[model samples]
Target chain A: MPNILVVEDSPTMRQLIGFAMKRIASSRVIEATDGIDALKKLSSEKIDLILADINMPVMDGLKLVSLVRSNPAYKDIPIIIITTEGAEEDKKRALAIGANAYLPKPIQTQELIKLVNSFISQ
Target chain B: MERETSIGKKADEFLQLFRKGEEFTHEILKENERLRFKLAQLEEAIERSGDEAKIRLYEERIKFTEDELNSLKERFRQVEEENKDFAAKYVEVEDENNNLANLYVASYQLHSTLDFNEVLRIVLEIVINLIGAEKFSVLLIEEKTNELIPVGAEGISISDVPKVRFGEGIIGTAAKEGESYFSENIHNLHNRGSISTETPIVCIPLKIKEHVIGVIAIYSLLLQKEKFSNVDYELFNLLAGHAATAIFSSRLYTQSERKLTTIQSFLDMLKEKPRR
Candidate 1:
């Protein structure tokens, strides 16, 4: 089973994402409240993929993506940004920052599952 | 004795001639029988060859018929595909025509009367019925304060509507810059403290000659529409100019009408005083 990391500020959002992921495939999910917590988990655990929210308290998703991209060890890991910011500029910035994919809020459960499965299998 | 010997020789010659004639007759009979058998064999062969030719002809005809049938089927299939294509194109063209018609009707209705409330009603109708927006609000800019005041709204309680200052929120920013702001996700506005109820999918500034007079906030689309189409954007552009003009003209007409009524009443009062 692959280990997945979910970084979000909201507990409900984290649970929703976790439920969607677990329903799609049997995998280990490590939850983090924000980017700072995510980094802490990353150092100790071998994470296969990351699903992160854009807005957070300590560090935002964009900053996390930039930091992850700069790190040589975790540079190649796939990062999917899920946020309520569906503007064209937001999408462009996320993709430019090395995020693998961007999913808008009011997330389609099946599409999210499919996207996760594709990334994990890859 | 000489005479007897001569007579015997003539008798022997006659008997030999008779035997030769009999042998010739038998040979002719045998030859005739052989020719009849060969003729029968040739006739049977000819008949069999004729039957084979007929069979070959029938086989060719069957093959030809099958090929013709297949060709016809292919033609039918192609025609059906063409018809389907034509039908799809027709529907597409019809949809385009309907959109254009709607724009025309909306333009006409906006300019139909100089009543400000009527103009707002018509705009709301176009937004709801034609554009398929479920929730929307029309806010006019107060010239003195440079704040947006909601004149009309749907899917929002009047008590809950918040006044937006110019250059503050998305609506205010749109009005301040005289630019339209369309957000596919409403959370961006929520982040800035503009909208509290539902997310607005579109925010358009009603402009007349680079001057934004008002703003239209579309909160959400109908369930059927996942996103705004190009046509919706076109409609937005149209509303930006035409809606502003309509509202401006109606306000002017109303003000002028009010002034005229006041003057007429004053004249009537003076005339009555003189008659008394």
Candidate 2:
């Protein structure tokens, strides 16, 4: 089963995203509170895909994306930015930094499921 | 006759001797007068040289005093400049210290509680007391409705406020955009009709990670405040992250605590029941 990492600070949001990921695919869902935590997890376990939020405390999503993209080992892994920063510039910047997709918050469960499914299947 | 002639010759010789002696005495007196005149001239010259030496010494002393005075004046100017520099530096340091203290207190009060209502109250208090915001409101976004609802308010009646949907008004737009909105003159903005024109407005989004959980609407500033300063913006940014995170964390903690208590009660009930 593919191991998916969900990086979000809020516990409620993390639970919501975890639930959606489980319903869509029978994959291993790992939760991380922030980008720093996510990086620690990535080092220990194999993460196939990453879903990240933008404005976390220790390290934000953009910094995480840049770090991941710069690494030789994890550069090819797909990253999806799911954040409340829904501005056009935010989306453009995320895509420019090597994110595979940008999804705004208050996201529909089906859309998230479909997005996660598409990436894992590929 | 011969004897008379010899006596006359002797007298003539003696008269010649007396004439030579008189000539020698006149020459000696002339030489003595010349020596006295030369001694007087030498004494006058020595007195004049002594007066000249005294004048030269006084001139040197005057020059030295003037130089010392000028040096002292230069030292005074340097000291004055240093004092001005130190005063300016002290003010800057004091301002920086005050800002740091404000941030420290704000962080402390924000994290001091885990109760949702207490968090809202503390945030409001910080905005009012620390930030010097006179009129403001704290609005949380209803996740289901995606609407901004006022939870706490000051200097304005709660009834006077209108319902704002997400991305609708200034407060809603700030929450929707997940960015801060500061207007020195609210009358110039698109949503002036919704806000009071008595003072400027600043809308800050309270965000946890990327999600904007709430918005802080500042309608007016204190009388002492003329405009928003960089420090005010810093405080706004602090509120955006720290305040939001505090509220979100507290809510989650309370919810989890309740769930744990419920689970513990369930276990207790099951243990009391007959073994199955």
- Model 2, position B69, has a per-residue lDDT of 91
Query: For candidate 1, what is the recovered fraction of reference interface contacts?
Result: 0.00
TM-score of chain B of 2: 0.80
**Each prediction's whole-model lDDT (CA):** 0.81, 0.79
Each model's fraction of native contacts: 0.00, 0.00
Candidate 2 lDDT, tens digit per residue, B1-276? 899999999888888878777777777777778878888888999999999999999999999999999999999999999999999998687566556655666777788889988888778767765565667888888889878888888667766665579997777788899999888564433332355622327889999889999888888654434455566777788999999999889889999999999999999998896977
Q: Determine which window of 10 residues in candidate 1 chain B has minimal summed lDDT.
A: B186-195
Which 10 consecutive positions of candidate 2 chain B have the poorest summed lDDT? Answer: B191-200
Mind giving the per-residue lDDT tens digits that candidate 1 earns over A10-114?
A: 554566577667655679899999999999999999999999999889999999999999999999999999876667789899999999999876455556778
Give per-residue CA lDDT, model 2, range A37-64, as digits (tens): 9999999999999999897899999999
- Once superposed on the true structure, which residue ranges of model 2 sit more than 4 Å away at CA? A1-122, B1-33, B186-200, B274-276
